[model samples]
Target: MSFLPASADAEFDLLCIGNAIVDVLAPVDAGVPEAEGLVPGSMTLIDAQRADALYGRLEPEQQTGGGSAANTAVAASLLGARTAYLGTVAADALGLAYADDLRRAGIFYPTAPLDAERAGGHSTARCMILVTPDGQRTMSTYLGACTAFGPADLDERAVARSRMLYLEGYLFDPPAAQDAFRRAAEIAHDAGRKVALSLSDPFCVGRHRAAFRALAAGHVDILFANEDEILSLYEAADFGQAAAAAARDVELAVLTRGEKGSVVFCRGERTDIAAQPTTLRDSTGAGDAYAAGFLFGLARGLAIAECGRIGAVAASEVISHFGARPEGDLRALAGV
Candidate 1:
């Protein structure tokens, strides 16, 4: 695919849409997870009661805006992109906080909030991350009012004004969210903008492989996935087969392999990007941050090899910290 410079009149370099969540982080003893009947190093969906109960057990150390696409949006903004985000949040305290975080990150978050509490609907979504002594994170996510995201909730003007639209795979669980994303993708394409999709999880791919395949083949111009997710998408026997299959579906296929590195396939060419060296602190959000860097570079019309390098550098920064978003100066690190 040929690259185009973003029009000066464009309001946004990228527009990201997905679940809006508040992430609560805590450090706990190794035995704490087993005692609570929780699986370590796993992300499980929980109900409101389970969310409340598990939260009470955690002595949280930090709370920040986090979710697959939201994390990418924040990271992209930090990389000097004119970014915007669209995620449905309830008119609750956590929801308000999620908006505030995007503001601080220099990303515009359009608010057409639902009063979930008054309407007897769900509250804001939250992920409770429990870090063990081994530096492994156990996450319990409650996808609350973000499921209420539908076609009506989208910022149509923002979709048209942005140069690229990024969709998060996790939000595909809700039937309405699926419709909403499809609608957003159509608007973006109609306006001659690019559409990118991140296969958020391997399990998420397994759940909606058919829908994902259809969307990738039909609408998605840029595709992002880790090793396991691509395998799940095509049920391919190996990574090579999965990579080749993905290259056939999308205009640009970017696949990440932890520790080893990442590969990008575009215009019948492959580019290998070596992983940047860094201490393994926490692996959460590494892929999300990588996508942010890659997309930001693509938005700036940078070469594919340089984009991959920036992505690897961004992933390194996130993993060296405890959270999904970077805590260090990423622009300085990547030398943008």
Candidate 2:
């Protein structure tokens, strides 16, 4: 089997696959999500009409580039890792803007834009995130052109050259996208590179629990999930039970429990890292940023505890801000 730095040609530290989306964020009262028939802490898929309706009701405070995997890739790049993104967008204004933002952030996005003639009238994807007073973010996403992402988008050489392949569970909705996910995992594993996956949301876990469990058991080297998602994945009674179960399936299982902190399980060993203390703001991209920090440390060959600490520090910064993207230099904040 091929191994890392296999040819003295490995070009990147991380390759992330997921939907490419722009995020429009605004602070709202706790009741806004409920008033819009959305679960207070859940991410729900909506169409363009629904997205427009929600956007009209709220005053947008920030319109920035954001996607689960993209956010992680960006944060990782800022932390000094060579990161690349694989996803699709329409050949439209938002799509071009998204590409430009990623390039400016020092991320390599190599996916081809969808041809307008063949785009079926879809625009670039947009996610409307409503942050509540308690720092919880509720999302309504319009997938748009992202649904067109398929296995054909994978760049074989790019996958083979990455140290780790990071996947966002949100892209598994489309059958073709699932095929692409499996193909990417195969490429990474075939090259003896590790694969990391994030269970994007609890409801997302509910939608494909069986498939995700199988992927974690057979393909994933590192698994990231929040308390609710891990519990949902295993159908266990609590965190302990779920974590125990998760440890048996993946080489490393990382579980985040909001204020209680996070736990990492590997080879019968469990380490708990305290959440970094910070003034809470919005929790929109905390998990993604945490993954970025953890992966960054892993790429640098840091100890597991140090990796978790870096992740905690990265997460703390995102939660202390309003939008999903970081406002300052995360590398400076991480002291990497």
Number of the predicted model whose TM-score against the real structure is largest: 2
Candidate lDDT scores, in order, read: 0.89, 0.90
Clashing pairs in 1: none
- For 1-336, candidate 1 gives per-residue lDDT tens digits of 436445666799999998898988888888887787777876788999999999998898878998889999999999999999988888888788889888999999886668855324888999998888767777889998887888888899999899999999999998988999899999998888999999988878999999999999999999999998999999999999999999999989999998899999985579999999998877778889999999989988999998999999999999887888899989999999
Candidate 1 scores a C-alpha RMSD against the true structure in Å of 1.7
What TM-score fits each model?
0.95, 0.97
Q: Give me the runs in candidate 1 sitting further than 4 Å from their true place.
A: 31-35, 117-120
**Candidate 2 per-residue lDDT over residues 206-264, each given as its tens digit:** 99999999999988989999999999999999889999999999888989988888999
- Worst-scoring 10-residue span by lDDT in model 2: 1-10
Which residue pairs show collisions in model 2?
none
Error of 1 at 48 (Å): 0.5
